[model samples]
Each structure stands twice: as structure tokens, then as C-alpha cells.
Target: MADFGEILRSIGEFGLFQKVILFALCFPNAILPFQFASVFFIQSDPERHCNTDWILRADPDLSTGEQLNLTLPREEDGSFSRCRMFVPVDWNISDIREHRLNETTGCRDRWVYTNSLYEATIVTDFDLVCDQANLLEVAQTVLMAGILIGCLLFGPFAESFGRKRAAQVPVVVMVIFTATTGLCPNFYLYLASQFMVGIGYGGYRLNGVILATEWIGVSRRALGACGTQLFGAVGQIILASMIYFVRDWRLAQLLTAAPLAVVVVYIWFVPESARWLLDRGRTEEAKQLITKVAAINKRPVSDSLLEKIVVKETEKKGGIIILIQSSVLRKYFFTIILAWFSLNITYYCLSFNVGNFGLNIFLTQAMFGLTELPAHILCIWLLEALGRQVSIMSTLLIGGLLCLLILAVPQGNAAAVTALATSGRFFANWAGSICNVYVQELFPTSVRQTASGLGSIASRAGGLLAPLLNMLAMYHSSIPTIVFGSLTLISGALCILLPETRRRELPDSTDEAEANR
Candidate 1:
């Protein structure tokens, strides 16, 4: 009797059938960037100042420019004060014209923004500047919190529900909430909507990857996994281009949400995992998909071949708790957990480093996104050439070492620092990209979604921490990089302890994984 890999080989592991699945799954992955990183555009704050309404009203004859120049104080850089103005006084033109106002007050009613590229933004709509500026970070943090929460929820849910159900539900939720986020009237409602998008995206994220992972055979699995991230990189670039035209945050939200809704209808075209089907004791359903896929791939096999395949029916259902109960699996799970956390921190740290590069923020961000595509292509080959464990360990090692190199370079040479940092980001992208493929190979199909979600929780945890950690540069320029580099180094050391799972049959349960070990 042949194993599943043998069966896959006979039926074409990466035929036209698998290619369709890859294309469909890549849609959601591309949309992933819009949820996680597009905030850089949506929340962009431009030149603004306290509302001149009181100043105009006080001196009825004062022209708009005259009122602003006379009433508001100038910042050290010669820009008008953004959050403050002189208390309106009865003083005549000469007193105000000479900038002689003694008492100053914060903006009483509202603020004004200069002509900007954006029609409006969350910052302008809700006045999220000054004291309110922190709320913007609050909204982003809430979304990350939702992502971490969703990571916890989806793992067990996907195991209990089928992968198809798991994949579609979040896409629907994401589409609805993401559209609603555009219509949000107030900041609080917008926060709620962003949090929901995060939840749905977090749930969709791992399950989609797992669904694609289960569909393809081992040799091409790394390729499929890395391809999703390439799509995400493309998504970022596409999103940037769209925002360049749309200019309004709400319209950008509506536009991006529409594509994911379209994908929801099309996700039905892809097949559920046969491995997941058999795990739930739906052997007939499993066999049906197998037959269909085999036919579609143009590789005909005898019914007797399908009948000869025997699967163990266990009473235990997979979940996070059950996964940790096995000691060997515990080692594997936690070590990968650290890798997930470290890679995420390192990746986001570089991603958010766009402003620090002494280049245009938008251009730097696009460069960062564009950098991931080739890195992912290289990473896929590295996973195949160097094998999983080696690829992950070496990439993390290289990324960490490069980040540390930034510590040695003199601070004034922006070009050298940026070049080294971009190089570091490239390697870190590969490290995170490979983890997408590597973690799935370690766990069995039963708890695969659960384990993947658990890993994502660690990743989101790192995401949540990165913004705060990056601020450590106020203490020392290298502090944040030093911390990020050290964590990846530690994670690399953890990677050294795991077993290699190259060109191996997919494990269906913890016992199966241990037995293979």
C-alpha cells in the first residue's frame, strides 16, 4: 500500500488542480497587507493648525491669512502653531501685528489643516492630533489585539469546523467589517470596525495557509506557502497605488474591501482538505475529493487503490490543549512559537523603519514591500535547497547578524545604515516567509490550524510589542535593533533543536508526528 505522498505523486502533486487552488488562496493573502500595514497611509497627518474661527470672528475685518499670521504663534521651525493660538483680545492691529499677545490658549472649537493630498483622514475627521494622536496608536493596538484574539479563536474552531467553513467565514466577516469601517461615523465605531477586521483577518490568515498547505504535496508545499506572502507583497504595492489615486481614507477602505468580497464568492471553487476530511471520519467525502482531484489532475487510478488506504479513527479531537499535552510536540510547538515571535518583531521593526531611512516615507515603504517579493522567491528555493531547518536557522542568523551590524556603523552615514538595514530586512523577510511553510510541515493535519493560529498569536504579540520597543531608540540609537537582533539570535538557537521534516509525509496527528520522528 502506498502512503499519501505516493498517492499524490501518482495524481500529480502540483498539477493544474493545485495551481487553481494556489491562485484562489493568494487573493486573501494579498488582502492581508491592507488590514495589517495600510494604516501608514490611512492615518497620515499633514500640516495643520488650530481653527482660526475665533480669531476671524474677533477682528471682523481681519483677512484669513492676516488672522492666522497675527493670532497664532509660530513653531521653532517657522510653521504655524498646530494646537494652540493666542486668546482673542481687544488689542488693535499694531499689538497683534507685532506678535505681542501675552496670553495664549489651546484651540477652543476645532482645528484647520493646510491643503493636503488627502481629502480627509482619521486624524482630520476625528481631530486625532495632539492629545488625540495617542488614540491613533490605540486604534492600531486594538486591531493587533483583535488579531491576537482571532489567532486564539480560529485554531480550535477550524479543527472542529471544516477548513472551507473556516476560510469563508472570516472572509465574509472581514469584508463586512472592512466596508463598515469606512462608514464609521465616529472614532470609537471605527475602532470597533478595525478590531473586527483584524479578528476576521487573523482567523482567515492561518486557515487559508493551512488549506493551501494541505492541498499540495510536500515538495511544492514550501512554494505554495511562500507564494502567499509574495501575493501579500503585491497587495501592499497595489494598495499603495490605489491610495495614491483614491486619496480619501474612507474611499480607500471601500475599494480594498470590495476585492475581498469578490473573493468570497470564488473561494467556493477550491476543494477542502482530504486529510482534514479523513480526520473527521468523513472517509467517503475524502475519497470523493481524492477521486475528483485525481481526475482533474489527469492521472487516473483504480478504485482499489483508494479502498486500500486505511486511516486511524481517533476519539480525540485536535486543539491547543491536546497539542501541548504531548511532550515532544510541546518542544516543537514552543520552539516554533519563539521563532514566530522573533521573526515578526524583526520584520515589523524593519517595516516600520521607513521614516528612519532618511528617504521619502512613501517611497521607502514601497521599497520595503517590493523587497519582500524577491526575498520570498529566494526563500522558497532556499527551503528546497538548504532544507527547512537549515533555511529557517540560517536566515534568522543572517537577519540578526545584519541588524547587529547597524549598531557598528556611524550614525551620520544614512546611506550606509539604510543599505545595511534594507539588507537586514531582506533576510528577515525570508526568515518570516519560510516559517509560513516550515511550521505547517512540523504539525499534523488534525491540529495544524490550531498550531498555526497559536504560532500567529506569538507573531501578533510581537507585532503589538514592536511599536513600543522601537521607541527605545530615544534611550540609545541601537537599543531597539539590539533587542530585535538578540531575540532572533535566541530564536535561531531554538530552531537548532527541532527535527527536519523535508520531503516527508504530512503528519495527521501528534502520535503520527512522534512516530515519524
Candidate 2:
């Protein structure tokens, strides 16, 4: 019997059928960046001060400046205290002026934000400032938790069910919850909706790559993997533009999610993986789909060629257990997990903290988004020229070094800091694009989606930590960078031990996967 790759060549490798599937799968990726990185705009911390409107009653004709001066205290930096207000008194405005009220307390009537880039964010709407600031981290953490859970749930699911269901269901869930996210009246509801969105994000992200790669020929697999990231990069750039104009978190959330509704309809029309179908003893269905693909690509194949396509089925089902049973697969799994963890934490830490670079947030974010285009484009070449192992190692190593170099930058040098961080992001993005293809290639087809999902779980765990690590900046500004950079370097060095998968056919069984070394 011929292997699936041989069958793919006989039908059409990068023909109309594969192109349609790739577009169907990759188009949603454009929306993913909005779901993944929207927090940067939605949770932005703007300048604020305590609301001291009680003083307005004291002097009805007082100017805005006079009201703030009388009602709020100044910080040591000479700025009005954001969370403190002078204790209100019934004394006349003249007496209040005489006393120059020194007594202060926490904001009694909420806070008033000024010079805000966003008209309203979760931070402003929920008053997530001062003592409540930690909630923003909590919200992001909740989203990450949902993503982790999705990975854990969907990894085995794709193996058990078809990849088509795994891909389609997530889009439906994302559309519902993302739209719901905009309607959330409180922080708690918003967190719930975001969690569901994260779940959808986690599942779709894993399945989309698996489905696309499984259908394409070995020669085009790099394009299948890296091309989706190109769309994701486009999504980020579009997100920056949307946030720049809309300036409202709810409206932006609604707009970003709108495209996925169309995806929900079209995704159902895309066919399931022929490889997956054959593995599950649905040979007739696989044969029919293969025939359909051949027809669409205008590459007619003989009936005998279709009949010869078969998958070697194992009595032992594929799952996490199979991974633990094979020592070689275990090594690949753990090493890739660490690599994924390092990449995600470093990438997201820089992403979520785009504002801290001291550059304009929109411009900085746009530049950051723009970096992914060339990164993925270069990744296609690097994967082909340097091979997967070298590409992963080199990008991670260089990205880490650039992150560490930020420590040498002077305190107020925004230009230098932004430059280094953006450069690090460029390499990190390249490493990320390679890792996406490399992880899929490292495991066998029976457990490919499962392994990818497991790897994503580690990635999401890293993402979960990113916000908490950003919290460490309070202890010291350099702490997060130190941790991100060190882990990245270690991950890069560890990739040296992994077997290269470039130019090799994907492993179809455990024995084939173990034999790659």
C-alpha cells in the first residue's frame, strides 16, 4: 500500500484543493491575534486621579484645576495622587482654603482617569487601578487557564474524533463567547467570556495546523505551517489599526470577532483529513475525499492508486499514554515542551507590556506586529536551508541575547529599549514560526494533533505566567527580562539534542517516529 504522502502527490500536492483548505484554515488565524493580543489595548492603564467631586459642592463655581488642587493630594513626584483624596468636610470653601486640607484617604467616589488613549477599557470600566490593578493580571491568567484547559481537552479529542470537528467547533465557541465578551456588564462576566474564547483559541490553533499539514505534500508543509502565522501577523497589524481608531474596548472586541462568524459557516464545508480518516478505518470516506481532491486539483488518479492508499492501524489507541511508552517520543515531547514554554513566556511578556517601552503604544504595537511578517517569511527559508533544529536553536539563542542586552540600556532611553525589545521579538517570532512546524513533524500522524495540543498546553502555561511575571517588575524592572532571557537561552541550547525533520516525510507510526533519530 502507498503512504499518504505518495497518494497526496498522485492527487495534487499544492493544487486547488490544498490551497482552498489552507485558506480556509489560515483565514481564522488572522482573527486569532486579536483574541490573543487584544489585552494590550483592552487593559491599558491610563493616567488617573482620585475623584474628589465632593469639593465641587463646596465651591460651585470652582475651576477644574482649583477643584483638583483642593481635593486631591500630590505624590512625591509632584503628580496628583491617583488613589488618595482629601477627607471631605462641610466647612465652607473659604475655610477649606484656609486649612489647605492635608488629611487624605483612599478614593471614596471611584477614580477619574485623564489623557486616556482608550475611551474605555476593562481597567477603566471596572476601576481596575491601585488596589484593584491585580485583577487585570487575573483576567489574563483566566484566559490562559482556559487555553491550557482547551489544549488538554482537545489534544486527545482530535485523535479520537476527526480534525474537522475539532476545528469547526472551536470557531462556533469563539464567535459566541467573543461576541458575548463585548456585552459583559462586569469584570467577572468578561473573564468568563474570555475564558471560553481562550478555549476556542486553544483548540482551533492546534487543529488548523494539523489539518493543513496533513493534507499538503512534504515539500509544501513549511508553507502550510508558516503561512498561517503570516495571516496572524496581518491580524496584529489590523488590530493595532482598529484600536487606534475605535478606542473603545467593547467595540474593538465586537469588530475583531465579527470575521469569525463567517468562518463558522465556511469551515463546515472544508473536508476532514484523509490521513485521519484512514487511521480510523474510514477508508471509503477517505477514498471519496481523495477522489474529490483529485478532481478539484484537476489531477486525475487511477482507481488502483486510490485503492492502494492505506494506514497501518494499531490496536493500541494513540494518546498521551503512547507518548510515555516510547522513550524517544518522551524525549522529544519534554524538550519541545520546554522550548514552547520559553518561547511563549518571552513573546507574550514583551507583547503584553508594549506600553512600557516608553514609545507610543499604537506605533510600537504596529512595529511589533510588522516584525512577524519578515520573521515568518525568513522562517520559510531558514526551515528549508538551515533545517528545523538549527533554525529553532539559532533564533531562540539570538532572541534571548537581545532580550538580555536591554539591561545595559540607560533608564530613560526609550528609543534604545524599544529597538532591542523589537529586535528580540523579531527573532522570537521567527523561532515561534519554526517551532509550530517542528513540533508537528516530531510526532507520528496518529498522535500528531495530540502532541501539538500538549505542546500548546505548555505554551499556554507560559502565557499564564507572563502576566504574573510582568507583576515582578514592581520588585525590580529587570527581573522579568532576566527570567525570560535565561529560559530562552536554555531552550535554544536544548534544541541541539532534537532530531531534524526538514525534508523528511512525517512519521506515520511510533516505530517510524522513533527511527527519526
Candidate 3:
């Protein structure tokens, strides 16, 4: 039996079969938000009153409860039409007040509720005053934890079982929960469902990178890896449109979950990665898979093709200890982690707060989702043509600058600020997607998934802080925006300190990575 390295060398690395298999994984990234976006429905405070800061400043005599019916212009456009901004009319004020005292300050958290409120509507039978916001926070936070665990675990599975099985496993797990998340009855049940979803998310995210990079030639790996993100944006679009038609969160969750059943079909249509098969010491299997892929792609694989291939192996196995133990890799690790954290915190904060920006929640989310299409295309284009580090740094800087710009605009200029924030969201999303490719490339192949997972865990750590930022933004005015903006700038600056990975073969070992740095 050939060793895994010899087996991989026997089949030309980064071949057509890997690309097709990776693309199958990309499909889910384009549409898994059905359950993930359930947070929007689950924590909604329909009874939420419009922020009365402007009103309170103008008329100090109005009581908080008395201000519920106050008429306000919907936007800075100064339309003659007036809208009453409040949570759903059915909420019991007394219960809300009690929740405010115990859970939120001043009965606020309306903005935080916007992204996650949908989960409440679908999973829980509770009325308007339920403290679903906290539940959602828990869900979002724990999901990241699952993502952390998945990222750490998938590489071993992929190494032992082969990339196809490891990558496909997430699709199966996601299929199971994506179908069942809507059925969760209690808050805890929903939280568990999200954690499961996060595990799948982590698996898919990592698998997409590994498979795409491994399948494509080194020259095209960045493009192919980043292409997965375009699917994530597509997923956002599909989810946004689905939400428009399926107003009920449960149905929306079901609709999103149902599409993933196509993963089983992949077993028939998709071939196992030749490179991965080789890595696991299965030369014959790798050779067979490669031949079939080459045939399907109409590329002739000559008899000498296997003889010409070579995979040089080094004695390196990266674990948690090695990651923290190496100085250069450790710096890259921490920097990527902080960058991931900053990105997710602001990204989710902006996304979840769409409903609070004086528009229909679905409409706002749709606009945001649609914006990502162009954002991603622009990102993919610029990242390749320009250097990765420059693009990543510039994007983060632009995002942070836009957020700071929002503060200079007056309260009456909320529309301008909202529009600016939307632009910032676009930049941040682009930066984030690009960073996924960028961070993974910085590490050696042997520990690629491990390093990626560590960064992902860090990113999730930032995600865990997002709801808190949303909650803070609700109370501290421009503080949340300012803080997130500052974080982005700091991350961008740190990113500048990192080396570029453009047009370079992935480092095969830590020594290779440090030498390049």
C-alpha cells in the first residue's frame, strides 16, 4: 500500500474532480441561512417603541408609555406620511417593562431583536413579551462554539477518512438540522439546533477552502476559494427572497433546510478528491477517481500522467500546541483571530440591525443581501488583480471609516448614516470573505485546517460579541458603531503587518511559512 503522500503524488494534485466536488459544497454556503437567519424572527420585539431620544429632547413631559403613539417621519426624506414606531401592538407593556428591568435596560433591545426575532416566531409559542432576545444571543454565541469545535475536528476526519467524506459529512449533518430547527419547541432546543448548524457551518466553510484550493491549480486557488464566498452571498439572496414569500419563520427554515437534501445526490455525481485520496495512501482509488474526472472534463490523462506526478512529504503534524508554540505562526494566528472577531462583530451587528433602520425588515435585509452580490464580485476581482494584503487592509479601513462618518451626521440625518452603514456593511462583508481565503493560505498545508479553525473560532468569538454590540448600540447612541469601526481599523492595521500570499504555492511546512514571512 502506498503511503498517503505517494498515493497523492501518483495522481496529479489539484485536478478536475476536486473542483466539481468543492462546487457541490459551495451550493450549501449559498443557501443555509434559512435556519441561521431564524434569529431575525425569534427575538423580534414587535411591541418595540421607536427610540424617543429626539422626542424626549423636544418634549420632556411625555411619559415613556404615553409616547407609544407618537407620530414620526419614517426617514430623513421628510415624507408627509407619519408612522408609529413601536413593538407589535399585542405585547403586554407590564411584562415588557419587567423584561427590560431584568434583561434589557429601559425596555430597549428592539434593534438586537430585529435579526433574531424570527426564531422566536417559529420555534417558541411564547407571546410578544417573551425574552427571546437572550435566547437568541445564547444561540448565536453557542453556534460559534460549535463552529470552533467543527473546525478543529474536521481536518483529522478529512486526513483519516478522506476529504470527500469529511466535507460531505457536514452536508448530511446540516440537512438533518436544517430540516428540524423549525420544530424546536423550547429556547434551549433552538439553541442546540443552532449549535449543530454552526458545527456544519464550520465544517462546510473549512471544507470549501480545502477542496477548492486543492482541486484548482495553485494559480487559480485564490479565485476558486473566494468563489465559495460568492455562493454565501447567493445563499443570502435566496434566503432574503424566500423570507419575502414565506413570512412565517418556520416555513422559511423548512424551505432552506429542504434544498440541502441534494447532498446525497452529490454522492452519485461528485467524485472523491484525487489529491485527498492520495494523501490517505489509496493510490488505486486516487488514480481511478482522477481518470474519471479527467475523462468527464474531456482532458486526456496519459498513462505516464501518474508516473510524472510527485508529492514531497515533510515530517510535520500540527496540533494545538504547535500552533501556540511557534512564534511566527502564533502571531499570524492571533492577528487572524482578532481580525475575524472584529469582522463578525460588526458584520452581524449591521446585518441584525437592518430592521431597526426605519424600513420593512424583509426589505432592508433583502437590500443588504443583494448588495453582497456586487460586493463579492468586486472583492474577487480586486483581490487577484491587486495584492491580497492591500485589498484586505483597504477594505477594512473603508468599512471603519464609513462607520465613523456616520457619527458626524446629525440625528435628523439617520438616512444618510444608514446608507453609509450599508456601504460599510458591503465593505466589511467583502473583507470578511476575502479574509477567509487569505487566512487559510497563510498557514502550511499540514496544519491548514487547524489554523483555519483557530481563526474561525476567533471569528466566532467576535460573533459572540455582536449581540452585545447591538444591545449597546441601542443604548449608547453611536458608541457601538464607533467601537466596531475602531476594531476594524485596528484589524486592518494589523493586517498590514502580515505578509502577502499571492501567486505563491501554499507553504508545506511552518519553516516554509516563516521563511516566506
Candidate 4:
């Protein structure tokens, strides 16, 4: 049998190069989801209400006019007006389109340029837009649903196939599909691409977390895991800056997809996780990889120590079910589910609703991504110094409270309200990042991927609810803020139930973790 203590110590140790590769592998796609979430700014047709069914009803005149209204918001001469109705395809005439005059109609037929009004007044005299809003919503929901399945599927695959192969494959897949999302001819094609993108995203995210944790020392695992996400913040900033330059959603998506090329180059530089190899009984292979890693890290390898650290199967057998069947782990999983859900909802809500912020959509996105740099850096600093529970709880609580306060702000100062809301988002995101790091530490290697996967799925579920919340908020003034605030607050309370893992060594199995308590 392997000396579990020695193995734990060895697994905890990592050097600078390993850290860099892990960071690079995990960083580029950080804001890919942001691209999807941020699409609300450009995708929502505020003026057109052409129903897909109506267009398909074989009504050439209605379909023709619907396409024109959808195009108007993108045209240089077209203008946006607000909508008074709350129907799914109804475009708010004042808030939906650009502020350009319809010179052709002498600015008299704003309804013609507006999607919903164009359908209602000019086309069918009723809703005619092809139910595009529902189609888009279904697309987003299905994509997230795929994320749930993909994360679960990756656990066994990452364990069975080895972390390096599992981690690298998804990067290529994500790049291809994410890029294609920009070229989608219509809603159906976009939906399919989103599903594939979600799958790749789930696999890469889980594997990256596993690889980072496996490479680092237990003393530094939280730092590595949390810091890995900082690269995501960097990714967000890159995407944001790119969006500012590109403006168009299709081009912006292409820019987001471009990072896959850099990740491919890393195939030559990055190595498989040594811990994963040892655990899977590939001692010789593990040693060979370790030698290369040690050389790159400029560290000397200790053969005897390395042999002592190789994990060997013991008489006691545990499987995936143990993750949920174990008492303490069950509690840990449930609490994290709540926190993850809360985090996903608010994070996306804040990002997606930038259209209502009154700032230019591109500028708002750029600012939102930039805010994470400070938030993540601050999280990294505080997590190490203050411990996970306190840092996470405080950040969540403060952020949730701030979100609620935004509701009381007087109307018409959209810019000021948005600025405050963004500030609240900064703090909320920092807290949420802390939670991601904290939950990973709470589980053992046997179920580490499983736990992270479940948490991610839960987070995506929260994302599933976001668009609905957004639609509601669009109609009811205080719905989004109140709901998001309440969810965050509840998550903050649930966070208190989790045991703190700060400055403690990682437990190797569910048995060890439960026993430690």
C-alpha cells in the first residue's frame, strides 16, 4: 500500500512552471460564457415582433417586413424606441432600437422600424415575429442543460483517460464550436452550436480545476484553484476589450473563439498531471512525467520519495456513490449547490442586464470585465489571509445587500444606477469566486471532480433561470434585484454551514475528510 501521508505531501508540492501552464490552460475561455450572457445587448430585437410561426405560416409580406425591422436596429440610419407591452416578442419601442430617424417614412412610422410594433401595426396587425425570443431562450436553456450532463460525464472520463488528454481535447472542441456560434444563420443553428459549446466548456472547466489542484501543494491548493480563476477574470477583460473594439456580436464571438489557437500551442509545453498518473497505477509513467516537470521547475527529484508517494489500492474500496452517500459530504454538496446556484444567477444577471444600464453596451461590457481584475486580485489576497469562510460570507452578504439597495435609487439616472449595480457585481463576483475555491477544498480527490461538476451544473441551473428573471425584470421594475439579492443572501447563510479548510492539509478520501472532523 502507498504511504498516504507521503503521497499527500507530494501532491501538495508544485513549482512555478506547472502553475503557469495551469493558469494559461484555464485562462483563455474565462469569458466565453460572458459572450453568451452579454448577447442580450445585441440580440434582443426591441422593435420587431415577427413570430417565427407567422413567418413560416407562408405569409410572404409579414415575413418580409419582420426581417426588415430586425435589421433596422443594426442599420446606421435606424433608431431604437421603447416598447409598452411585455409579450415575449414585443419590442419596447423606446429602449429596444437605435435612436435614428426612419428617413424613408419621414420618421412617421417608428412602428415600421420597431420589431413588435412593425409586426403589430405594419405587418399582420398582430404578433408576427417568429417566436425568436422563445427560440433563443430554449437555445440558452438547452445549452446549460448540456453543461449539466457534460460535467457529470467528464468525471469518469478524466479519471479513466488521464487528466492531460481529457483537459486538452475540450479546448480544441470549445474553440471550434464557440467560433461557429457567431456564424449561426438563425436561432436553430445557434442553439445547436450552444449545446456543443456547453459540452466542451464543462469538460475544460472541470479538467482545469482538477489539474490545477493536482499539481499544487495542499498548503497552496486554494491559492492555485482561486488564482486559476483570476486568469478567467483576465479572459473576461480580454473579451470585454475585444467586444469594445468589435461591437458586433458575431465578430465579438469570433474574437472569443480565437484563443483556442494559443491553447493549442500549449500542447508542446504542458504536461499531464503527475498525481493523476500515480493514482491510476502508472508509476513508471508518473515518474517519467515528474522528471520532466521537475526539470522545468528547476527542482531535483527524489526517487525514493517519489516511489513512496505512488498511490496503491488499499483493501477499503469507495466509489462515486460515496460522494453523495457519505453524511458530511452530502451536506457539503447541498450547501455548495445553493451557493453555486446563487452565484451563477447574480453573476449572469448583472452581466446580461447591461443593456438596461444606460451606458453603451460595449462600454458596459468592457467595464464589467475590467471590474473583475480588481475583484479577483482582492479575492486572492484576502482568501489566503482571512480564510475561506469569512472571506466568502462577507463578500456575498455585502454584495447581496448592495443589490437590494439599487432598487431604491430614483429612476431616470440610469447611468448612476448602473454604476452602482456594477459595483455591487464586483463584490458579488469576488465572493462567488471565493466559494468556487472553497467547495473544491471540501471534497477528496476521488470525488473532487464529481463535486466540482455538480456545483457547476447547479450554477448552470441558476443560469437557466436568469433569462426568465431578466424578462420579469424588464416588465416589473424590482424583480431581478430583489430575487438575486434574496438568493445571494440565502447562499450566504448556507455558506456558514460549511467547515473552513483554511491552512489545513487536504484529506485524500471521503473517509479521511469525514474522519478529520
RMSD of each: 2.6, 1.8, 9.0, 8.5
Per-model TM-score, in order, reads: 0.92, 0.96, 0.78, 0.80
lDDT for predicted candidate 2 compared with the true structure: 0.88
| lDDT scores of the candidates, listed in order | 0.79, 0.88, 0.67, 0.65
lDDT of 1 by residue, 293-346 (tens): 989999997777788666656547647777678888888889998988998888
lDDT by residue (tens digit), candidate 2, 142-240? 898888888888878888888999999889999999999998999889999999999999999888888998999989999999988899898889888
Best by TM-score: 2
* Candidate 4 lDDT over residue span 356-455, tens digit each: 7777765776777788878878877787888888887888888888888888887688877888788878877787677667776787766666677777
Where in model 4 is the C-alpha error above 4 Å?
1-14, 30-34, 37-40, 46-131, 314-320
Separate clash counts for every candidate: 0, 0, 27, 35
Better of 2 and 4 by lDDT: 2
Error of 2 at 409 (Å): 1.6
| Ten contiguous residues minimizing lDDT sum, candidate 3 | 101-110
- Candidate ranking (TM-score, best to worst): 2, 1, 4, 3
